[model samples]
Target: METSHDDDSLVNFADDQDDDLDIAPNPDRFRDAVLYGTDWTVRTLLQQIEQGNIDLSPNFQRRDAWSSRNKARFIESVALQLPIPQIVLAERKEQRGTYIVLDGKQRLLTLAQFAGGFSNDHSLWSESAKVGPLRLSGLKVLPDLNGKTYQDVVDRAELGQFRTQFDNHTIRSALIRNWPDEDYLYEVFIRLNTGSARLSPQELRQAMKPGPFTEFLSVRSGDSSVLQKILGLTAPDFRMRDVDLLLRLIAFQTRLPRYKGNLKPFLDDTQRHLNASWSDEQNNVVALVDRIEDGLEFLIKCFGSPREVGRRWDDKRFDGPINRAVLDVQIASAFDPNVRRAVASGALDLRAAYIDLSESDLDFGQAISVTTKSITAIRCRYQSWQRALEKAVGASIQMPVLPNA
Candidate 1:
């Protein structure tokens, strides 16, 4: 399932230095792996899916796979016996019979979704969501088949007396097994999805770095309704844009000591370590995330509405729309001890104090808006916050010192 970019409500900046970064293939090394082609009739493929042979979970899909119109056109081509594009899959190393999709996940899902009644626990990203039958529409080549279900097509061909080409056509597929690691397969996806469905940095990071920490991040990001509301997300971003922002928060809150101005490598380094030590570190990780969530909720209280979370003042008044730069500093402040005390105690008139500081502190004002990737900008936010929070709470709030600070 592919998601449109409009869902990302946060403002975009040219920081993070990640737009052009990628893990290039190791040039000095070569490895051998087995690759072969296979055929699958729709019925057989559905059977495999029902039997849990294929993985089409949120992690496996490109999210919302494709639009209904695109799916209908593809189904029409199948009905016309046109040569469809090849699908690619990788045979699981431990469980050879089970497979994970390297490419063509949506095509396979489309087949299952159109078939109707196809149910698998992990098929779709959502737990309650299932692959129900789709009514074919917008069929250009096969206008006659439009609005027909799979069974409708079958029954029209013959109510037990005839058969349709759709019921028996075989899809071309290639299966690669004995890959060196899952990372290699993810790289395969990076190469395969270079067209209209290129992977975002967060998406690529998710693929390239697979671990319990990443899995934990995925689960929490999808399940946290409060977090979703803060980000104006009713559901998880199919493109993992919501997840991207959450990752930034997690990195800043938990690993500010390791930040080196470049967010991309800093996040990558932190995730790699936490992922490897998740078993021993999970409890602490959960606690940190809870604190971060606490900070998020506290901010909402200050603004009086979740929708106003990332909102800041414009030149004249506090009328600017929600943006990512505001979120960056706000999230970074979540771990401050004084803020935590305010969060725990429900400190009074904190909203007034917050607005006052934002209005009076010119440096904090500028830091929350432009060229905010530098140590000066970040330190200004935390340092200025110490004064505001100390005044509001009537106590000393130890500032969270960053590496370059």
Candidate 2:
């Protein structure tokens, strides 16, 4: 739960989140994805995990919610022969019976972590996720088992009687055999996860849209100094808001004219098309990333900080929370080669112009705050900023040419 001091980066960003998961649901994909129910004994499940047959959606595993104590409690639940929730997985067509865990990742991981016995290397999930071997504590019903590790259970030192009992226990599992490409998986993944648990917008997108491009976004979003500075982030957002921010920048850079008010669908379409053609567009995508980076560096130089364009001001310091509208415009505008060049050398200080508008311009304020995701508002923000840039540079800034749709 590493958090940002910036209110908008973590709290406000997550509170507002995105448009909706079902905004672009496809009924066709719903019927196409298939699931079958089965049960696996504790021994077999651990074996499968050890063999690396059970994958934990590596792409979308950027955020983790389970605590060690919670994991220990779940392990205790198994030891007590209490019924645990069913696991859900997607059977890989490439390898029959081998699976990618869609749900119950924590349970499987906990089981693997505990059952690794003495060596952490034997705990497949723990070793892969870099978690240590489980050491149980704080058992309400099983105080006798407190402070015991899996090695203790195996060594016949104490609590050995219950290990065989634990091994014999079975857990229910559902295997999805078929999942055609679409957003339906997002709905099922959300529904199956249950109980106020929702993946952040970009987290869900990685699950729904898996491709080299999506992976590219995930990597680029992590460990970014420029991003950390701009979002006021102490660390990359666990909610994948940082990842979503990169996707938004890419979307608006290439498809701004096509964005008709709805940000969710606009970004969705962009991901879908780009992912399908990522092989051909990899070079172009790299260039786009460079453009955004250069533009941001220039903006930082002009404004004295990235926050100038992204964060709102309260007459003095840049204390106001992030306005997504302003950030997007600033980022999208930076996509232009011409704009970046002008911004880098122009006599006009973008920070001053932005502050002037922020304090005095009613229209800009409304554009940023009211129906901010609306097409009207988005274009209004861009046009207003463009006017300021052009006025400062004494020339019209041409928009970057985009690839054919």
Candidate 3:
């Protein structure tokens, strides 16, 4: 189900909305969602870090993705007194004054490292531990400053001038506080990070809003048997597209005709709701997972391989990306009580009958021709498949009422 703002404006799941998360909906809450102050100097930020006020955990960032060279460049940029973007932070209730880094993690970490705080093992500490000394090399602007570590600058007044400049440099930080809704923070993180990093929707969800349902998806996505049967072993899931496909299946199983054409938002809403209801909705989750597992096993039994099932159209070859259009419908039909009875009674040869119908059905081609993103097309294809399957199995199954029908 999609949620709206206080004014009933459509809120995009992947984007930030200026809405507060009070059940009573107050305009003042919206205005007070985030709290910011005047720009802070680099020195003050370092002091905050030293005082154990800023949390620099790898909650959202790719750990250690930045190279030493990259860190050097950033430190050099700071020393040169170049302007940088404001760091976004979120205040945690666990610590009254302590804040968590939402954006600008790398920049903040680099500064902390330059001040002799980041341990070589990839953690920033409040104490100025000397486990790993900050060093800068390969300087284009100042060749003399090359190969100088933070210790070298502290010892030399001339080099210390640059260090002083860097310390005094102002880095703005915007703190988000008094926002009771974690969902809004997730949306904001997605919007801010997606522009610079090419994080897939699933990846962004995994990083920004990890929950019980997300953990469930991650575990199921790695099930070798299910994936080998559905997506071929070599199916490159670099972007976590397989997880997305599973999410699609789950979305359809749960939300059905309630789904509109907004694919991303629908998936987002489904996941959010699932995560929210994870404990209370355990039975639904179990039933849905069991049904899908049964459907996949049944499909594999009939087709030999999940990859063999697709929208055949006029071609003798299976085509497209596993054709979810075909999968969703076939699974729904296979689970039909009448169809199951026919199969159990040896009246339905699912494979042979399905192949025959695909070869002869003109309407099936038209149904699959509609864009997969269209809800109408998805429903049409499912209905067409159900009709074909009913004829093949000699089962008279009733169609359920769909949303917006």
Candidate 4:
């Protein structure tokens, strides 16, 4: 789902055209079909199974490995005339598979498992004893015309007639695989998935986009061990999704305030800017991350016991305190080259100074007042240090310290 717009509005450039098709055709005539009120049957399922078209992407809900209670409840829903979710499937003319599941993978898996006499528990029907392959059976579907049940028609059937009827039942299928017709797919996906475990645009992008940076962040932030450590320090209830957003904020050094839950477009724009502004030596992103990491080490040394800080090195507070310090460091370093040298040579005693300054009896407001003065002093000291270093190195380095903004 690539688009060229902000989070509020998605502007898809390609309309309804096949990926391989070069010719542009009428968009109105090439509409996605919606088939309803038909019995999805065993023969179609078997055909799809044989065609290698069934996609159980991790994005889909977990397999029907539900507890016995949940399985019983689902069966009871069908028995008690409760409305179950309609399965969303796609039918393609070019594809042999009768259906491409858009939704309802769990329900379908449960049905298939039950019909095959596979036990929900770890018994014969479980992995041990291979029960016969599952197929829809004993299903008493009601007729649409009247309230006639499968039992009413069963009496008029011969031996194996029930299986034949079940196999030949008309199954409703929806087709949506037109490459140019992505908007239609997007609209349909949105309509069907909205309000049901609604995934944000950034979340969706993380799933869809292809890039090393996205992959690396996903691994680092999505790891259960890493997440557990982060939670132990910060809010344990904080979602991994939020962590990803914070990473993007740091990576781009965006001045944007705390995200108001609309991060998709912001992420997209940031990625675009990063891709354009990226350079090998002057890679602000890599430099920014390294600086934040260094600053975090300093904060931990100053604010907590060195042991505790190192143990909870990836704490969320590191982002707030240490990352901010790194930002200031970068700003100060720009005006005084020796600030970078001090950072490199450990001349400024960052950890000790940070600890001494932060532990003072001052509220955040008071601390900010002192911090402002301290930063000015540090900047001045760096300018003097740079001149001395320049003289020793026999290379004149100009310092341009900007006035306070």
Candidate 5:
């Protein structure tokens, strides 16, 4: 990392570190050294901003998240030749010769807007509307300047002085297109922005260089209203952490036969595989989703029924085994060939099966509890059910009848 901490340029805006004040002349520290003279021009910077090439990572705050007054003040300060803080840029490997914004995002954006002529009506700027050409002639001098005011300075210019002044007042220093290495840039981004609201790793992942899977999830999270509805019903106050868990579970379910503890590396591997597979991976995802949905449906059908018992059976009623049996049904549905076939055939009536089982006075909960005896009983029952289903399906025969038969 190439860090520039020139004490001479450091501006101590206030003595109180505890005060809620933004530090001035925040030095541009680069962890990675970059080849100089490889920098971009003002026009190029504006073009990148317009093209959305300049991605603001979690380390960078949102555009216009700063107040309009602060933005206007910043613009005014720049127009009057006042010092603005240096911008921090991290070289990203994924972007390939491009940089990610760390600090000074707001100031850089404000300058870009001015250069692009996007500061017409202050309200338009307030709304972050990128319109109108910047009227360089309208730029005023600092009101608190000790020297001549802006109008006085500009008015007293000779015939060709205006063009010369405009030409000389360059605004190209704000762009940081050169960085030596990614680590240096990342360290600077972390340390310099320590006191500020820090970005979580997930957020950083999204901002810096998100892979296709992350982008896909973001798009799906917004596009699939049905999924959101289902999620809200299941977990209303769902957080990003919970979303990560869901991702892990989905990965585990989809990539059966292989299980790993670490989700990050697993997700990374999955993304690489997905990228390599491209269209085929998408097909697999669709298939996996369908299977999971079918499994859930089977669970609901086999367990969602109320039962009443007479005086003799009432005292011996069991709910624990019943619930465990329901869960077991769900687990079995995931791996059962018969269940897969039933779903594929679309001929099995799960509701009827559920109703019939509900009337059978079975102590399902006790049959699948944590105890060894319960587990043994549950396993035996599962094996019996598997064998009976296999026989019913005529697994050894050349042909088998559908479930309705």
Candidate 6:
């Protein structure tokens, strides 16, 4: 695992602690009349799975966390006609007729696997073992099911009745049809998962809010080649820390001046906009990603391996876990097409300028200041970096400014 801070850059945006804001209080606050739907049977739910209606690859939690033994227990529970907990699903209005799994992924997956062989896609199914006859064991109440596979139960004439009963079993499901407000959906996800286990905001956001940009981030962060070359990480953080860094870079580059003190809300708003699936925006995303890659490559060529582009960024003096503010400013600044051209054409003495700028304590300190999330701090840092880059490249490129200023 990469050495991330105990207090991660993304985790400690405003403060290390989460505020106790009373955003929603009751079931009525969820607007149950319109969005809520009643429970569903295991049979009906399986039909939806077969029809390709439910989304299993929500980028939130690791899939198939439950062991085969755990799956066996659940399958045994179903056979005994036990009343399992309800599954919660969020209907994706934007995708039109698609639903994402919010909770009960394990239970739903167990039921499906028992019914049919596992699918090849690991995301769709919970476990790695391909769809085959489910083998159940370690049961206490239903001792007869011990060491029995699904085929055994189905083939035996005497046990045939048991199979029929198991097939007719039901599991409750709560459908959230319309989460009108983004904040409301955020709150709902937090609320729903609190009882079972705590899920980080990033995890919930990835699962609940699946979109084009989020998908892009997932792919970009997962690319080991890029991550290994630039960030100096042999293995990516399974918790998706790299993804968070990429998001922070995009937010600062595109929406820095408008940034308020809070990072989560700012990121949330930016993500909602990016999720709109605009053709032009998609093209721009690709371009920005390419520019970032090019910039990182340029740094590596100039400075050699384990290229430290930030955190006291000089060829000789580079050390420390890559600073967040430094990373944001440098990567965002590198997105300029003119900057890329200058480096390529030898117009920019990037090696000398970058090393010189790194040694300037006065300039770098302002950017990596204590209250770094504030608008003043964000703008100051970005402008400082941009000015340095412009000077290095000898270009009069116009930079983005605050709307009012």
Please give, for residues 1-405, the per-residue lDDT of candidate 3 as tens digits: 011112212112111121112134446655758677558888889778666577554321222335577778778888888987888877876567787666675677677777744444544442235335567787798666778877788788878788788888888788888876655565556566555533335644554345788767766665535654565544224334456667777887768767766566677788888889999976777687777778777777777666665434347766534555566677776567787777778787777766776777766655554445566766666677677777776657654444453
Q: Per-residue lDDT of 72-169 in model 4, one digit per residue for the tens? A: 34543444445566666655445544445555655555444433222245222333134333322333342221222233334455424544544454
Q: Which regions of candidate 4 fall more than 4 Å away from where they truly are?
A: 1-38, 46-51, 58-68, 76-83, 91-100, 112-179, 195-197, 201-222, 228-405
Local distance difference test, candidate 1: 0.67
**lDDT, model 6, position 6:** 25
Would you list the clashing residue pairs of candidate 4?
Answer: 15-180, 16-180, 16-181, 17-180, 91-174
Ranking by TM-score: 2, 1, 6, 3, 5, 4
For lDDT, candidate 4 versus 5, the one ahead is: 5
Question: What lDDT tens digits, residue by residue, belong to model 2 across residues 1-405?
Answer: 122223434434422443455346457776787877888888889888767677544433344445667877888888888898898777766678787666676677668668843234432333344655678888898877788877778887556768877887889988887777434555666666455434445655665566788878877777666876776666666567778878888887777778666666678788888899998999998898877777677668767866664776555767544556677767665665666566566665677777877787777877776557766666667777777768777778665333232
**In each prediction, how many residue pairs overlap at the backbone (N, C-alpha, C within less than 3 A)?**
6, 1, 0, 5, 20, 2
Worst 10 residues of 3 by lDDT: 1-10
C-alpha lDDT of residue 59 in model 4: 25
What are the models' TM-scores? 0.67, 0.70, 0.52, 0.37, 0.38, 0.58
Q: Which candidate number has the best lDDT?
A: 2
User: By TM-score, is 4 or 5 better?
Assistant: 5
Candidate RMSDs in order: 5.8, 5.5, 10.1, 14.9, 16.7, 7.4
Q: Once superposed on the true structure, which residue ranges of model 3 sit more than 4 Å away at CA?
A: 1-200, 234-236, 310-314, 344-346, 398-401
Q: Highest TM-score, which number?
A: 2
For the record, the alpha-carbon RMSD of candidate 6 to the native fold, in angstroms, is 7.4
Question: What ranges in model 6 sit over 4 Å off?
Answer: 1-39, 57-85, 91-99, 113-169, 177-180, 194-215, 223-245, 255-278, 291-327, 333-372, 380-405
Q: Quick one: how many clashes does candidate 2 have?
A: 1
lDDT of 5 by residue, 1-405 (tens): 111112222111111121121223333534335523333444556565555566632212221333444545654665445544555555566566465666555655555545543334432344344333222332245443223333443455442343233324434333334554333444455566566433222323345435555555444333332333322222211112222323433554554233233323444455456546656677666565455445554444443432210001223342311122233333444456665566457544444333333344254323333221233444443444444345444442111111110
